[model samples]
Target chain A: MKASDGQLIGYEKEGSELWLWDDLPELHMEAGYRIDRLLHYERSPYQEISVAETAAFGRMLVLDGVPQVTEKDGYIYNEMITHLAMVTHPHPRHVAMIGGGDCGPAREAAKYTEVERIDVVEIDARVSEVCRLWLNRDPSERADSLTHLHHADGAKWIRKPPVPIDVLLIDRSDPYGPSAALYTKAFYKSVYDSLSADGITVFQSGSPFFDMKGLRITTQRLRSLFPVVRTYWTAIPSFPGGMWSFTLASKGTDPLLGCMDRLPTDTRYVNKAIIPAAFELPNFIQSALD
Target chain B: MKASDGQLIGYEKEGSELWLWDDLPELHMEAGYRIDRLLHYERSPYQEISVAETAAFGRMLVLDGVPQVTEKDGYIYNEMITHLAMVTHPHPRHVAMIGGGDCGPAREAAKYTEVERIDVVEIDARVSEVCRLWLNRDPSERADSLTHLHHADGAKWIRKPPVPIDVLLIDRSDPYGPSAALYTKAFYKSVYDSLSADGITVFQSGSPFFDMKGLRITTQRLRSLFPVVRTYWTAIPSFPGGMWSFTLASKGTDPLLGCMDRLPTDTRYVNKAIIPAAFELPNFIQSALD
Candidate 1:
């Protein structure tokens, strides 16, 4: 009774086990994990959030029918998106994570002792509630980085915050619908203006393989606003195209030039070597932007 | 109505569309491709070979329920497997391709004028015949590098060739079943013996993400024999784990040390920038092998 990644959630429907394939129509493919059971599913105020436990990949959270975060490889995305910016900044005390309602990135950001406070601005509160209550594996900590949550537009929240942010990590949905505005150059300019002098921003660009135009155009736009822009990638097995791209932008600091003198030892994906290696964009990807 | 990547061979079954996911049980997941129609399927004396026309990616060739080659990204694998070592060598005269039954590797090798001859030792003749007949888009030439096809066991053929190979490319299936011997130290010893004094060898190891042990151990064995060994990677979007690792070994000339002076201007994947970047192993992979 084993199935491929796109086995479409169930074998015989109607009364059988309910399964789902997060259909990526644009890519003409769908991706689904092997789920032991669908633990939770409902239409939130913004998008549909479904949480399921998989026999292979632990727990998987699908939002808007997209496999947003699975317990298995969520750390890879979370670590790269958050730590790349945090480590790049010499002294990152305050961090702002946008749309990572799952609270995975904040959990990792909180690991740094240098981080004094974190402001998580998410468009959806239900995502944070479900993840905090049932989805996420309890770290069993007294006060973790799941600290402040702003159920408001992330684009607007960055315009005027209480204090200037040192690191901004955009962990939002695909660049579509309300998330589309976050991808614009104006929004990035707003982010550039509302930051400390040495602040760094990291955001998921898109799949460099299939969505070449989107990634290429986005990087081009960022280059216009930021003094330094670097593109890096990692393989998320559950996501469509498998290869996911993220761009790092800094006003004056080059992420590649900014070295990790003091590094964390406990990480499965991100290590000292990857900081430089990941930035080495392939020939096709480099050409795609050109 | 839309099929997944591995759904190439099965669709519109009986009357309704019943897509099949080619389960890579080893990886504990299946893969599929969008299929407009199934072109051909039969046992090719060695394994099952199926040809299907896809909507997103062009033609797909599935071997033993595995979508081994797709026209969309076929050049990526073929170029990386062949050109990485070809370019590494100063002058590759005689190239021996083992287990590339589809004749794809030889077709790439034939492109270089410096390559006088290519001996394609494929155990499965039917794969070459099938590809040449239907799957391959020919270069419109008579007697290309694919002129010579020695349909024999690659493991045995490497022990005693008519002339020693200047460059040896192992383009076989995974290190399993009939292809298991090709991965052994004894077989590698034979390959080393069959190679010319400055011969270089490049072969697919395994995915570092899931098959960490396989790739690590294989690199370990290769390092014991070769003076210079380097591991590189490329992202094959449709493949399981998304990221695939390739290892390069040389008798005297190092792949990384070898410079790219004259570059091909027609390639979509391989270029001067990628030659070094690919060899920059991630910390996790380097640590796993270490």
Candidate 2:
């Protein structure tokens, strides 16, 4: 079936075997995954959410026809996104997440004993509830005490954060439809104001291979508001373009000079050796940013 | 349609539009590319070869229904496979490439004035012919003088090299079928014997995310054969799993201590900063290797 955006978005069912077809019409590419079973499906107030048991990736969380995270490889994305900012800050007592409804980032941030509080502002509450029941099944993995779940618009929540945050992680969806406001200058200004003097804001920029223009614009906008801006990348197999980028904008601290020794040793992806190495962008990416 | 292996391997035609589907049944994933036109198709003595004009990736080369190289992002794979070994050796005068029929690696190696000779031994001559005619069309981009294309079996040719090579690059397909012999200890022994005293050999060692066991075995075999063995990775979007790993085995020279000042300045993906950075494996990959 064709989606409202004229892209193919449906499962090609063959008896009990199912294949989820994710078509990226803009990039003229498509990825298909074999589904073992459908766990849950719902149309939240904000978007469509679904959960499925995949043959290779175990359980997967799909948001509006896009695969967001999977059980097997979720550690790579969650650890990369959360730990990069967590270790970069000298003392990140309070952390605020913009739109990580899956609680993957919250779980990772909670691993750091230095973190005292984690405020997650997600517009869709169903996403959090569903993912918790399906993806995050381990009781020991839950960050219950330090995490405060707020079902409010991230843009509005950031305008007046309850406390100054040392690390602001923008974990929203793509910059489109309802999420477009989060990519604007006004939203970025609010993020800047909600942070401490030595705060750092890290967000997932689009794919370096497919979304060079979007990455360039995001970096430029962040550079306009922050003193130090850097871009790094990691590979997420579930993403359309396996290569994904993240941008870091800091007010005063240099990310490269971060305390690498403070990095959590239990992470699956990030390590003390890779913290500085991640910042070394390839020639094409650096040339694009320049 | 399904291939003989029961894997889906055909282009889904929608009116005039076609999407070439490359299915990795083992990984339970499929990737599709929109084809502008089919340029060529043939059955070689070794495998099936086809060329297509793709909407997102320009010209694409597919071997046995597997996407090998695309003109747009081919530079990343070619440069990474060529330069990492080229710059590591102090003075590499002669290089031997095992199975790069597309001539991408040869073109990259030819950029250096120091590289006097290149010997490319490919089992199938038709692959070289088709790629040269369709994928590599530029006359100036051709490495005509330095590269010697030998239409012969690479595993056999490496056993008795014409001369002592300073760098040996194994650019073959996955370790299967006709190429399976290239991954054995006998083949690696020949490669070690064919190089100079301080020679370095680099080969693509499968995807880290999809083929961890293969990577671990390959690293183990290389470590047994060479004094220094290291595995590094770069992102290739067209490849399944996106993240690709390459293993380097050197006789005496350490890859990390190589002369970074000698890296070619005109390459698109590799640069001085990324040369060392690429070697820093994430914790998961490191743990797997350990």
Candidate 3:
């Protein structure tokens, strides 16, 4: 597919056969690794990567084509999404994750043995099947923690949550296609209603740099619905904008308040010292909200 | 350049020419703009961007490009790098960003007017010169906050910092080469010494995902030096690994503490509701420390 003009900017080849579009800009890769849809393309830091995978989840993103939840950098998203709410609740016995088919967040949630039952609400059943086949090769891992996997619309599912859930995670896709509706204030209000009084909800807001507008909109929407609503950003290199943001809202204690004292041991990232530091915001973001 | 036999693979480009090389396969984008170096390049994101200023600062590092700061998505990096430290320190008298010559962080940092002063400590004066001329045009908008511009070494300068700095942002290049010295425990200690008793420090650590080994080493190093040290990750589309991490340390209260109570009414991205949410860590990160 060519960009702008009728530029044939995409191509494919099989073994010795090569096919090139007339207008597709020259790709930096070799003649191998079949070119699929470009998830996100841009300049800066040697060109970022956040494209979908034709092989998995129908079209799951392949940011840099490397695994975001590998043994290396997985902690940032996995821990914050799961633990922030999991530990915040006075007693989070039964938990559920909405649209976390990757198992990255689910894998992180399972660490809390206190979470006796974990449910994953995924839109695409294929993603879970693929993850079970490829991503999570060990059945002993998330398999033990995951009590149920429901193939259903996350938004619709949360509106009338079946069972009593203490913590709910909205680890869905970007706020664009199927995931766009999830960003609305109504969906979050439903999420708030679905949770127990002491429950907490966390979800990945878009990048603040490029999606500051989206971040603000979502944060505001969530704020109107939840009593305790907050927005924080993190940095992951595989997204378009170098900076990323997340929103956490709870009807319980401030996640930041007394968090340092209660921090768990064996953490590679969060600690007592850095607890208060994560809440700080840079100028641009501060200006955006103010 | 060309890849050696069995060395691994990494690639980047300039103009119409594409280059490839071999290494361990680590791609890190530091300070949101420059590619520090290519550790490995077997498979890379070179074909992602329109080539032009490939070797602007240094070589288009095809591999081991130093995993500088990873966010789950880009929002956290922008938000944390901007808000986490900026909001905590009450009325940052002056702010100096070292190595963030690209202006993305600087632009983000400028949102705080309490930061009466901002100085960008850049090593390659050429980088700033070019960015000002090409990339970041509104120098008057944000760069004007920069009270000073120093081409000297950020490490050396931090040892004897200027202006009772309330916040010293080490937004430097990757943790290698000239910047490599910046990531040392000793360097962070200097940063610790440079800030006011209540001052805070936030800088990109590295990709805790792919650089878990590096994150462990750096976290261990930084933790020992500072009374409070925490590592958090964000995601960026440009980086190889999706999950990126940052370390925030402070001499006063925990960095994640506080709300946007003092924020000017004009601010856009930060507020009380969003404050505590930033401290939330994904589960994988929590497990890493374990």
Off by over 4 Å in 3: A1-72, A137-146, A176-181, A184-186, A258-276, B1-290
lDDT of every predicted structure (CA atoms):
0.75, 0.85, 0.57
TM per model? 0.88, 0.95, 0.55
- The candidates, ranked best first by DockQ, are 2, 1, 3
In candidate 1, the second chain superimposes onto the true chain B with a TM-score of 0.91
Winning model by lDDT: 2
Superposed model 2: Cα runs more than 4 Å off = A1-9, A138-142, B1-9, B137-142
Q: Candidate 1: misplaced stretches above 4 Å? A: A1-19, A111-113, A133-147, A177-181, A184-186, B1-20, B111-113, B138-147, B175-181
The lDDT, on a scale of 0 to 1, for candidate 3 is: 0.57
lDDT tens readout by residue for model 2, B200-242 = 9998898998889999988998888899999999889888878
Local accuracy of candidate 1 as per-residue lDDT tens digits, B131-203: 8777678652523634578889988988888888888998867777558778888888888898899999987
Fnat scores for every prediction? 0.43, 0.81, 0.22
First chain TM-score in every candidate?
0.90, 0.94, 0.73
Q: What is candidate 3's CA lDDT for residue A91?
A: 71
